[model samples]
Target: MRPKIYLFGDSITEESFGDGGWGSSLAHHFARTVDVVLRGYSGYNTRWAVKVAERVFGAAEGGGGGVNNEEPLVVTVFFGANDACLPNRCSAFQHVPLDEYKRNLRSIVSFLKKRWPTTRILLITPPPIDEDGRLRHPYIENPSNEPERTNEAAGAYAKACVKLAGECGIPVIDLWTKMQQFPDWKNACLRDGLHLTRSGNEIVFEEVVKKLAEEGFSPETLPVDLPLITEIDPRDPLKSFQQ
Candidate 1:
């Protein structure tokens, strides 16, 4: 039987299976060794992800009593994105506050460990934002719809998460740094400079695969050609030009 991997994350993971997020791409990458079960939601924070553990993995929710005896081999927990973002939809500039963000991430990891005692956890950081402080838009023509949120601050948040994950003895994927090295990362996001493009999703998928391999996860066969959302043309108005 293929090992089951329970994925807990935010929008980037959420978009994978639906319209082309890294989560969906991951399904293909792990097809040879593990079955992917995505439990990601848009706009959900680490705090909220902990809630899913109670809601879906709890006995009252029709899950295994307190332990996940069913699938115990693998599980990935990713949530800092929304947690580091503004609390409500009302303000785009507001954030969850750095200190609180750390606490929430700790809670999320602890909760998963308590439930899935033997599961392997992989914590992923959100991607980097464009350095110019300007975001690209797909449908909208102006930046009025989206407010400036600090990508620089995200590095600190990611490090905090990495530190916490270390306490839990889990591996982490530094997506922020990887995206920064990409020549087109700045111009690869959708209308907003936050989300990733199909190519971006591919980059994420590759990184995860490489990390999993480094962590000693060797699958007999890996799936490579999973369809993704439509690709955006660089010259298109919806696409941003970094150079």
Candidate 2:
């Protein structure tokens, strides 16, 4: 059996766009040769994930715990998408201020670490946007709720996450920078400049694999049932699509 890694997060983590989510891509990348658990919820923020964790990892087997006493579990927390939705969720960046967002993120990590002291924790920064990324919806008269999906405010949130992870002694995958490097990357990666697309999911998978390798995690030790996807969309001319 391979080590069990649990992913907890919102739509981007859940791969709601078919196989366009990072979690799905990650599962495909490792599932063919390792063990992976894809547990992602749509339209949920970091706050919601707490509820899921409480149910699965609150106590031990004798008391509704997340541990099975038979497998090594690794938990990865990816959030802050919906929280950053803005406008509708809040009054344009009022809901999850950088400080509050950081606080919540830190709280989640601290809780999980305390619960599973031996588990590996990975903190992923939310992806970028096209124009109006901050404004969530229900737009009324917010100047920031136009077509500009690229939320400059998101950078603050991402930086806070990195800083927090560093303080907590955990690893972070900088998806923000990776996405920027791709050509016309926004189109292939995200459906609405906010959500991820099939190609975007591939980028995440690639990054996760690289991170695991950089951390000295040997692929051989992973389970055989891990999802290993071979190809993506071939119709697109990009080499990203495999066989």
Candidate 3:
């Protein structure tokens, strides 16, 4: 079977298979070499994610609680957009306290490591927020109409994520800091305020590919599951299977 890569996070990851999305880009880039699995929960926070992780990661093949025998090549922990929402705002229902958010991330990393010690795990921080853009595209009705999420708040979460990765000795994609480095990033990277645009997805795809390469999962490094059509001889197609 081909190796797998699991994506775990919220709405941004849930929509990552849409046109020009990073997940799709990675699937295309890897082709026959690996499988990219999406396990996204729209509007989910780290607090909620930890509760359902085992069920999500456990394999359904042998039985309800059976574990997938083959370890995934990598698993991405991408979250915090919703967790960073202001506690007193319209989206307050989704807000997770900062300290708790950090603990949840640590718990998640611990779970993945205990379950699959050899698997490479990476963390992706929440992206920068565009306050005015969020106001323009409000997700829910608000009595005060204030933007529920701010870039400053997201940055705090992002920094925590980065620090966690450093402590764990794992790779991390600091989307919050990286996106801002680009000029007009608010317009270029985000669609509404938190969700990603095509360009934003590109940054993710490129960064992930770099991480995968560093961990020895690139196209040239990983073995393709099947031989190319050209590799099969018309007269003796069976020869391809022998290899």
Candidate 4:
């Protein structure tokens, strides 16, 4: 079986398989070498992720929680955008307190480590939010005209995520900080001020691949699953296909 990478998170991750999406880019980059799996849930937060852990990762039976018996090459934990929603805003239903958010993130990392001891776990911080963009592309009705989320709130969540990753000794993609490095990140990197745009997807794809490469999963490092035509002697092609 091919090695696999799993993605877990909220809307941003759920839509990662779309056209020009980072997930799709990864799939293409690793085609014929590894399988990329998606396990994203729209509108979810760390708190809810912990709640559904048993379901996503089957009950702790026979040692490995049952997403699969094979240990994945990497697994990404990305949740926070929604967790940063203001408690009194339209997205209040999904609001989770800052303290609880930190606890939930730790719970998730612990859960993954238990499930795949040898797998590389990567954490991704939530990207910065554009208040005007959110208002323009509202996910929910905002009659009060107040943004359900704010850049400040999202920054707090991102900081917590980065700190958690450091404490846990895992690599992290600090999208919040990285995106802001671009002058027009609000429009260039994010489509709805929260989700990624094509350029944003490009950034994610590059970062993920770069990180995975450092962890020894580069294209040159991975063995190809099947022989390319050039690898076969035209006169004895069958020999190259021997399993």
* Candidate maximizing lDDT: 3
Give the least accurate 10-residue stretch of model 3, judged by summed lDDT: 59-68
Model 2 worst lDDT window (10 residues): 132-141
Kindly list the per-residue Cα lDDT of model 3 for residues 1-243, writing each as its tens digit: 888999999999999999999999999999989999888899999999998887778733433452475788899999999999999999999999999999999999999898889999999999999999999999799788899999999999999999999999999999999999999999999999888999999999999999878888899998878888989999999999998
Compared with the true structure, model 2 gives a TM-score of 0.75
* lDDT of candidate 4 over 97-216, digit per residue (tens): 998999999999898899779999999999999999999999778888999999999999999999999999999999899899998899999888789999998988898998898889
- Deviation of model 4 at 47, angstroms: 0.6
State model 2's lDDT.
0.66
TM-score of each: 0.75, 0.75, 0.95, 0.95
Candidate 2: tens digits of C-alpha lDDT, residues 19-80: 45566665666655555676678777665666566665546443665545443456778887
Candidate 1 matches the true fold with a TM-score of 0.75
Question: What are the lDDT figures for the candidates, one per model?
Answer: 0.66, 0.66, 0.91, 0.90
Q: How accurate is candidate 4 locally (lDDT)?
A: 0.90
Between 3 and 4, whose lDDT is larger?
3
Candidate 4, residue 134: Cα displacement in angstroms equals: 0.8
C-alpha lDDT of candidate 1 relative to the true structure? 0.66
